[model samples]
Target: MPLVEINFDGLVGPSHNYAGLSLGNLASASHGGDPSYPRAAALQGLGKMRHNLNLGLAQGFFAPLPRPNGAFLDALGLSGVEPAGEAERRLRAAAWSASAMWTANAATVSPAPDTADGRCHLTAANLVTMPHRSQEWPDTVRQLRLAFADTAHFAVHDAVPACFGDEGAANHMRMAAHHAAPGLEIFVYGRHTKDTGGGAFPARQHEQASRAVARLHGLNPAQALFVEQSAEAIAAGAFHNDVVAVANERVLFTHELAFADPEGTYAAIRAAQPEAEIVVVPASAVSLADAIASYLFNGQVLTLPGGAMGLVIPLEAWEHPRVRAYLDGLLASNGPIRKVLPVDVRQSMANGGGPACLRLRVVADPAAIDPRFLLDEARIALLESVVAAHWPEQIDPTDIGSAALARSVQAARAAVLEAAGLTELA
Candidate 1:
């Protein structure tokens, strides 16, 4: 009852709240001559910006939300943060400790003030899993704790080392057993024990996903749903925050993103609670129109909406006309819209996330929320890809033929190496 809204985009790592500025897990941040930190100071990247907007959506149902400081330019207070491990615990004993983390699939970065190639990125290891992965994302954990502390358990994929229930089949059992929430529950959707070990996705990824679900059992949730997110084929392409079936009002459907099983999602939700309202988020983040565009350029992507249904598209369709036009407008204007430009098309196509990925709605006190109201999702896309041909993200001019973007697939890959490590963990 305390959590009323969910944002897929807003679930990145936590150094700050959804309504707050993007922060990094200094422990996992890219060092070795990487300027991702300073760059993050000047310009909040599209992915990270979208994360802020997604968190803002929670304000509609939650009352008296404070306005976030748009400019966290000098806010690298991460001097004390640490990656999850023995050292991180040592640092947390005194004061702050990152509760949990979001594995980042898309990275939201910013350029250092007045610098072109120099940039900084604020991220978590929620979606990405590699060598540089984090055991927890301090920023995301903060938001989840503030918003979902009352829930039985928060959702996460268990594709990493040292994850909750991964020690055994009882791994799920082990995680659930350790959980403190009276009714905590996590939904493991993929091949936990499915392929035993060698499925299309690495065996570890499946085990980790299942362990995350298993970790939720201790809360003894009323029920948890599981589905096969990936088919026997491709790894990406099925993320969307389209329809969330509450106990069963109508089925909260998002206008921005969609899923392969929209109706099924609604059906499953209705089966649980017939009285829940099925509110439709037709205007949140990116719309069906944007989906159409991304479908063209970007092939497919993934999404996480807390426990709600999330949406995803591919980066291939980012070149669509409507997407570019709309995004260009966001960058051109100077207003609140610019602040959330990351949520629009800019981050949508560049990173694995879309507008729905950014932001979370905090419900510190249960009494403050309305329980059934939908939030506004007004955001314009930014097209930073126009100069994709230049360095920083240097693309070949011959390949671009005058239409250059800041990053190409290869460039983005190199730019966010730390993020890549996060994926390896998964």
Candidate 2:
């Protein structure tokens, strides 16, 4: 039988934050950049830049993941992995202890005091890489994973495999499925099985990607499928390497100038499966065929304003109503997003990420997908069962308004601590 229903609640990371983080990576990685330009954001400082704070959503979004500065003081193999202590260790340090870059902004930014009235404070960990992982969006990737676990399963090896070079093919593919509009299995054509470039795992290495996708079954996005390499896709230029497809077999080629014309790919797909809902759209302004006919080989070669990529919008775009709608619709429909980043990053100086890129579409059974996907999650369910067994008469978080959500979060934090086997925190 075809893959259908999934039990997202079955999967949980150390933190409730991770659930949302992983799912966000799903959608964020699937997103494509503004077509007017081809390439995406630039890498930050050339060296191990000093640390800086990254500010993001207070409640609905993920906080940040900082790195440990010096060596460790491990006792009893139980390092600083506990929830409460982890939070303290991550958020305790002063602002600029080490050289760090804001993966979201792709520029030199500093942490600012968030003066929100009633919101749960998020923690950031001290994350580090030798010589620093170039341009790879480590922070954004982690935060997105945290967002994924918020609603979907958060498995580091299963959801985001550590084997596929440094790019994390498993996470990228799971993310592809998570963001795909409903009713369609989003496919990224020209996917690489292995990371050829020092950073990116182009859709070309199909072998590694195929195994990665195969293992992601039974999670929140049990239905999302991914495939590696296509004969037609190989003919396209280097940039035109990826293709995004939906569950109904609808296909969309990402950019204009890549390899062969996506118009041809669409034609082939249509001929192969007449019923397949395939569309050859471009991230740029022109049609795929027209773009090829005009540039790559003949016609008039024109250069757009921003590099192959276009102008980056502002970060506030996340708060925009239309942007919200696009995100909501993409989640409900299962559309896929394709961008050019080592990981799933929307590091624009302006709006930060592209459409449907910032939000995490962590799906469970449609029947179970509540406005706040966290209500019936298995971990919470277990916590509820425990609370009921110990003390029947208890308070519910919904009874409070935004003002008291912070307290509710604290209670929830205590419950999480209990679940994670740390008594001091509880």
Model 1: per-residue Cα lDDT over 307-331, one tens digit each: 2222222333335556556445534
What TM-score, over all chains together, does every model reach? 0.36, 0.33
Each candidate's lDDT (Cα)? 0.27, 0.26
The ten-residue window of minimal lDDT in model 1 covers 170-179
Report model 1's TM-score to 2 decimal places.
0.36
Off by over 4 Å in 2: 1-59, 68-163, 166-183, 189-207, 218-253, 257-347, 350-357, 365-426
Deviation in Å, model 2, residue 189 alpha carbon: 6.1
In the range 1-426, model 2's lDDT, one tens digit per residue, is 121221111111111111111111222223212121111121121000100001110112122222221122132222443325533332322110111222211111100111112111112211211122222244444433443333332222222232332222211222121222223232333434243233222332233433343333222233333333333323332212222211211333233333234556445444443444432333344333332222211100111222121111223323344433433443455433221112222332121122122222232223322223232234334544443333213222122112243344345335544663433323
